[model samples]
Target: MKEKAEKNKLLIGIILVLCIVILGGVIYFMKQKDQNPDSAFKPDLDSNAAAMEQGDGEDEPDGIRIPGYPSITIDADTTDVKMNLMNPEGNPCYFTFEIILSDTNETIYTSKMVEPGKAITNVTLKHGLEAGEYPAVIRITTASLEDGSAMNGANVETTLVVQQQ
Candidate 1:
């Protein structure tokens, strides 16, 4: 009886230690990821912005994320821009990304607290277009978290042709 009790106590001690180690590891990783959010960004999907079409320019991030380089299509007259996005995780209670038309530094889209497992799509752009060629500078900004605790951010840029409408 005494031996069995000692063995059970030892097993419990080992289990407790293991749990602590696992919890600590999780905390450490979370902190590291938070400190370097850009590192976690995945540029797997392609961006469907207007600039992508018509062989336009792209934003070059110093250390950020951008989906594979893909072009977008443009038509004459009125221009329509589309922006598609995927939420990174399911727990992003409130995450935000900013889309800017660089030419005028105008914010075309601002998504807030996008739900995870859901895809954000079909954001249209609005601006007067001329017959001449123009650089539709674009900028996309995303952060690591939503609780103001996030510091690292990622940005992407691209340009599009504005045909005279």
Candidate 2:
């Protein structure tokens, strides 16, 4: 009887240690996944801007099809939009930027021929738009590339809401 009790105590101790090890491994894996950009994790503005240049070629357009750009979200009171434009396709192309709100079309900004590869541009609006949901459209024209360049233009419409602070 004494020998059986001692063996039982030893088994319980080993089990507890195993559980602790498993728990630690799980926590470490969760942290690592959060740091991965490809995951559903959205980093701060600086990291997010860097990821804009990367994409999944599986969804990329073929033969001049415009790839959809990510949507933008901004606070209504934000007067200036800090943004970076990326040329994923390794070829030079032309692009036009516009905004449409409530059926009214207006040219908020434009980019003259973005050079091949990544071309980061900062566009400042002349006037701050009213706080509301608007359709952000980017029309890309590739007059040079033979395969039309795998250009995924802006597909995201920004929802600008002004919050009273």
Candidate 3:
């Protein structure tokens, strides 16, 4: 009877230790998952209209095309800015335009994905700026048409002229 009681206690102790180790492992994995939530999430390339607009031909350039931006002017009191954000034809990727203020590194405007041979004519700024000439950058981010993965991009430095109307 005494030997049987000792064996039962030993079995219970082993089981409890295994349960604790498994619980610790679960907690560790949960924390790791929280650290990198979007590691596995990939944006669908097909959903972007730009990806579908890619033209197939041997004439298309093998390399990415980076577009340039001229200095932009806008009214001080209004957030509406007239600009043309374009993705050149024969390019193989999509373009995303981001207009950032140079002094504060603040992004005033971000355009939707512009497909090849398409353009966004107007954009609403995040906020109106004071009447002054501000140095700015037009940061272009290119994404692959095949997989929506990020590709080589460009930053075109320009001036943002905010004038009182």
- TM-score per candidate, in order? 0.39, 0.44, 0.63
Q: Which 10 successive residues of model 3 have the least lDDT summed?
A: 43-52
lDDT by residue (1-165, candidate 2, tens digit) is 999999999999999999999999999999999776567522122112232454556564544333454555544555466555554554344333444443456656555554444443455565666666566555454444432344545444553343322
List where candidate 1 sits over 4 angstroms from the true fold: 1-70, 74-80, 88-95, 126-148, 161-165
lDDT of 1 by residue, 1-165 (tens): 999999999999999999999999999999998889686544333243212121134443343334421333344455354445544333332235565655677775565534333445664545434544433333334444344344334454554444433
| Candidate with the larger TM-score of 1 and 3 | 3
Give the number of the best model, judged by lDDT.
Answer: 3
Q: Estimate the Cα RMSD of every predicted model relative to the unseen true structure.
A: 12.3, 16.2, 6.8
Each model's lDDT comes to 0.49, 0.52, 0.79
| Cα-based lDDT at residue 11, candidate 3 | 100
Per-residue lDDT value at 135 in model 2: 62
Write the candidate numbers in order of decreasing lDDT. 3, 2, 1
In candidate 2, list every pair of residues with a backbone clash: 69-154, 69-155, 71-156
Cα error of candidate 2 at position 82, Å = 2.3
